[model samples]
Target: MLYQSFREYAQGAAKIGIGLGVISILARWVTGITIFASPEALVKYGIFGGIGYALMGAIALMAFGWLGKRVRKEFGDGLTIGDFFQFKLHRVGYWMMIAILLITSIEGLFTQGMAAGVLVNILFGIPISIGMLCFFLFCVVYVGFGGIVLIQRLAFVQVICMFAAAILIPLYFFIAKGVENVYQGIRLYHPYLLVLNNHEGLFFMCTGLFIGFGQVFVDQATWQRLYMLEGKKIVPTFLLSGLIWATVPLAFSSLIMVVIFTGSFNNIYSLLFDLIRKIDTIFLLVLFVLCSFGAVTSAFGAGLHSMISLIAGNVYPLLKPDANERQKMRMGYMLAIAIGVLSIVLTFFFTPTLLELLFFFGIIYAALIVPLLFIVFSKGKVDNFIPLCALIGLVAGYTSRYKLGNLDAVWVSMMVSSLLVIVHWGSKFIKKQLGNH
Candidate 1:
């Protein structure tokens, strides 16, 4: 009896742990763009740039735990972060925050849609519009009908497939070609990639970190995970996921490097196509397919799920004000389908190169980072004008990019907003003191 009970307990614990781990990987780490974007950075900027890309994502995931703990403490049993914000913030402030959230979330889905279109083009040689529709259909069915429980279940399979590919594919290549050959090949074909301290490269790296922190902290999918996991499980899950997630990008980036070590390509997409052509081994092709699909689906699923939470908790509630859980869930499902379809349509026409796309949005993400950190970490309510400061800084930063360049634009924007908010608050404090006197 004792032995049986112990076995049963262990099995149950394993079930929950595995479920949470899958969710961590799928909900936070995996994304359609992550697969395409990280390797693209590697090729454009160098291997170090790829490493920077991966580190940005991992760092963001680890830091989110701090936000998670505070959120749960402030609003226990909440299904979404918006729920907490809606309750804590007054009407004007709540709407302001919600508007920002919706814009960011939509941007995220738009990116995901682009990745899905690209993946479909690669996998099936189909029109991007049709492929995008298929992507939308899958997300709608899984997230809408399956709910959180099914989403979590699918995540486990996705995580397992991702790890297997990240591990085995790299291992096979290193073993077959030998590490020295790959290294020498990289040196011969792309010598600049080895130079880590290049001035332009280092500058981008620092700015990338700031943009990374903002994107991770403000992302709704990540916030949803914060409440779903056991409180103690939150930090460790993020830390472990970060460590494991680091390996995927490094491995995939290196895989691309191995392909290019022999010759040049037209662009990132060309490199991907070339890699596909060069790999005649059926097993390796299957592995690549699984890896690619896993990355895209994980990202799409997380984005869809979080989008639902925002609509259900933030937008719908404002209109209804007295919705029950079932009504909220129904609205959530409807919103997911509508947004998914819209993103798919938008993806059909997006033409920017991957790095350019990231840089374009990186300004907005970086501008919001400090303001959010202030909101979460500050002792009391922040300066009301701080949100507007971020908006102004974002516009200013991107507009000045031609004059200052991308890296400098980020630094300047962050500094300018910080100063403006501080000055704004100081004047308010001075007036309050004069009134008291």
Candidate 2:
């Protein structure tokens, strides 16, 4: 169906049921980056990487159920995350977050585009630039024009394919290869993977929890999804989605182990390509490609659509005071194309490993988690310092990178921001005591 109003374009008038609601949330979170990055994590941190990565996201989703409950209680209606942000934030904080949201949204799309570029290059012998361009354009057409109705409809199908691949491929690999053969191969080549006491892996799980919380809290797609569900279903839907979503990463991680123990691979992408090339089963190979493609497009589409909805609903009216719903919807379509172009361009020039990309974004996610928690849970108008805490902590985190490793820098950002939040609350209490005197 053709989308006329911006709300219809964004969320299909918030009429989604618990079943599709779960699928939509799954599509948003089980993204291209998650699929590729989980395997990469397994390669680096061994068994801990696979399970820890999956567990981190599962916990984040479950935790968001709590935040979602409180947020709906306070202000139950909204089109985008920006609607909630505008209601809670003063002018300065509102604009600061809007700017950050735009940046992070673009970063999200670029990362997905990178995954698509790599996949197409491996499978079809397409140039990375051209493949990414096609990916962006396809998303723009589907998400920009088809709107949330189409997104949800496609999400239902895409989700089934992804789960099928994650389950069937791993089950097939393990059964055919035999558990003993794979286990011996790993023990022979990478025995460290079996170590029960992996210090770095433990650290990754701990620090990764912070990143996961912040990411889910601040994510535009997730917040938009909050307003899309029934009031009673909010907590349970989010919690269940997290539990089921956890399986994809762990399964994908095991799927990669099918071949990686055979020989040394230079990087995750090469290892992924090798896995694909080694799979002699034709139907399984087809399923893998579809899974990869579905993951990338669904993720990119979600990010692209959320941003367009945010701008059309929250930002455009400020620029065009007299604009109507259709006009804003039109602007949303334009924004989708523009953002898609920008994402493809950036992905073309700025390429990083999936692990590197995650750590880099971790600073932003970590610093914002507490401040956003403040925005939702606190009473009265939130202080301007709430948003400033994120900005300041982000700078401190990235700046400290010279002296610290990537994960440590991310923790530094979270701590600094949390400290600022504490000071803000402490000062408020002190002023109340002074007034009593």
Candidate 3:
């Protein structure tokens, strides 16, 4: 039974063990965007680029395992990432972080909402608006009402759909088309894809590592999962999830390769359509639809739920410290619907390509990574200026975007934040020495 009690609704039945943790995390990470983006990375940066994308994600999640262990040790009993931020940061710092986190969570929801619309339009010839409306409505009903227990249960089914598509689709193409023919086709058409010494591919891989790290590190949904796991199981669960997650992008990218090796395509979406047409089997078509929809809905639902938790747990309590559990629960459910509707409206307006959207936010992720890591690893309360470091980085990063290009802007943002932190701390150390003298 899902959420049989109030306690179950609030915290789930019990701390998730390793197996469910891995599967649930997988469901969260194997997003609809990943299905498209993995292939896009392959087309843009070559075969190594695809592999790099997979590696970046795996490493980020594995690294989070280390952070998760530390966070649990520091704050063993917490409901959300906001709880951790409230403990670690001063009032102003905590507010700033909460603001940024809320925005990022909304952006995540919007992205998934957009993907759902796109997938439905492609698969069923429905209007994008109608597709998104139905998608968000379903997510709101299930996740908003059912809570974490229901989410975990649904996650198992979603992951099964994703795994089936990821494995069987690529495997079928390889066997039916013949591996040698595919290889020969690629060699003849896109020689760059095969080149080992691809400079652009290498650059993308390096930058992607930074983006991936920051994305996972600051993600509320991920942090929520970290809190949901048993103390001892945390590290192993994340590490195993990372390892398993790497294969998804790799497999999805290979499936794209099956499309590429056959003929020329205008864009990533076109290639996806071409692949679908080639598959030409109703069973595989149904599988792909389930996989895509599941990925998008699961991701959107996770983000929406986590955002509600942050608002209900952190924000509402600040306004009404004496609020009861029933009040908080009511606030969470109401906020979920509001956020779901907001995501649909935002998705309608924001029509950028997926990569464009990611790179635009890449600046933020790059800027946040160093400051966040410093906060996580610091032994004592960090200076409030540490959080300001993200603002400074964002300003500098965006200012340089036109001149330096998107990827370089990300590099600059990270460098600026890292420099500020070093200089700020170094000056403090010197002042201490001078005062002692």
Candidate 4:
């Protein structure tokens, strides 16, 4: 019955055709992070950095299809990445992989929690803690009870609202200020943003690309979407999603330009408030509200649901391998509520600016990219120590951040980890050759 329900959801989605699917995909991928973080990037880095941040995510998502195809082909029927890793890897390796996944999941909560807090503070003048609680509660209930069916149903609505906002918000601003005037304002007030090729900016883009690849490639939420679609639609769904997803960040970044061009703001939330006040049209304000809500909720819902699937399918089953389907479902629902509560609690205590949080998470993700790619693409079992090398890389890169500086950390981390992986494997290869002789 559960399988039948899943089949109906997947196929029934086709009745709306690819357009709706594209919108749903857009909503799922283009979350509050893009809405809040891109502008935050604009405030801190420059206009180019803002656009780079957006581009990185879109590109990451576009390339994830390759990873998805590989994963599905290897372990076609598995429900989660953790499940696939458990079957393919040794106990030590599997635990190591799950540890990384769990860390990423925690970071995912942190990221979304920050974005939710910022949005709530922006839209309604609500306290971040109160707003976060409401956001988490909504996500937990919708995802836990409705499962993927309702998540996707609301994702379609979310995406439509997001795209409408993306197009209309910028269009309204561009019309008001005129493109030439907006450009002049950016150039005059925030000239640093206008310059694209600063050395720090260039390195940021390169590292961002690597980090982007890892994020989309390894993310469980994205992986869940892979199997949820028809095999034929799988590639196109991701591809079109990427294309449509690109416009959103660009639009949001440009909207921030409208904000920054007008005057300086102290923080991202303040910039959002400024934008809200500056807009003349009531329709646009409502659109902003819908877009903000949709972006936050789609991401929150996907995270909540995907995390539930991970815990139930991957973690719970380990202790109770013989558990029935209903038992698994019950565990999943409970876990969904637990994660939501944890996210709300976490939001209250820790608050970092959205871009800082993104880069902080980016370092860990960047470290994992080399090892994960090696594992996925290599023939047969790649060396287990590769992931361990990544852990070392994250430490080394971060240690260097204060000593060497921010831009340099990404490079140091990537190079150190990649080189260590080679050295670690080389020693093992040489030892094995001697033994064979």
The global C-alpha lDDT for each of the candidates, from Candidate 1 onward, is: 0.72, 0.86, 0.84, 0.74
- Candidate 4 regions exceeding 4 Å error are 1-21, 405-407, 424-437
Residue-level lDDT of model 2, residues 1-437, one tens digit each, is 67656677787865666798899999988888888899998889888878889988999998898899899888987878899888999989999999888878877888888889989988988987789998888888888677788778878878988988988888888999898899888998888777779999888888888888888888899988888988889899989999999998998989778877676778888888898987789999998888889888888888888988998899888789899988887786787678778878876677787778888988899999889988999987898999999999989999997799889999999999999999998999999999999
| Ten-residue region with minimum lDDT total, candidate 4 | 6-15
In candidate 4, what are the lDDT values of residues 1-437, reduced to their tens digit?
14333334222333333565566567667877888887776666676676678778778777776676777677666666776677566677777777777777767766786678777787668988788887777776676667767877788788778878888889889998899988888788888887766766766777777777767877877776676655556667777778777777778888888887765668677788888888878998988988887887888777766777777777777879998766776787786676567766776677777677777777777777777777777666655677677888888979988887655677777788888877876888899999999
Off by over 4 Å in 2: none
Better of 1 and 4 by TM-score: 4
- RMSD, model 1, all Cα superposed? 5.5
- For all predictions, the C-alpha RMSD in Å is 5.5, 1.3, 1.9, 3.0
TM-scores of the candidates are 0.88, 0.97, 0.95, 0.90
lDDT for model 1 comes to 0.72
Clashes of each: 0, 0, 0, 1
Between the candidate structures 3 and 4, which one is better when assessed by lDDT? 3
1-437 per-residue lDDT for model 3 (tens digits): 34454446646767889998998898888897788788888899997789888988899999999999998898888778888888889999888888888778777877787788878877777876788899888888887677887778879889999889988988888999999999999998888899999999999899889889988999988998998889999889999999999999899888877888866879877787787788877898889888888888888888887887788888887989999766876787787677667877876666776766777788888889988987888876777898899879978999999998888998999999889988987898899999999
Clashing pairs in 2: none
Residues 1-437, candidate 1, lDDT per residue (tens digit)? 12122122111223244347535655446766777888887877775688888888778777776777776676666666677666555566667777777777777877776777777777678877787788778877766655556666667777777777777777777788888998898899889888877766666667788878878877877776666667767777777777667767777787887678877778887787777776677888787787777667767777787887678767887799898756876787787677667766665567665566677777778887776666666555554566777777887898889898777787777877777777876898899999999
* Pairwise TM-score winner, candidates 3 and 4: 3
Cα deviation of 207 in candidate 4 (Å)?
A: 2.2
TM-score leader: 2
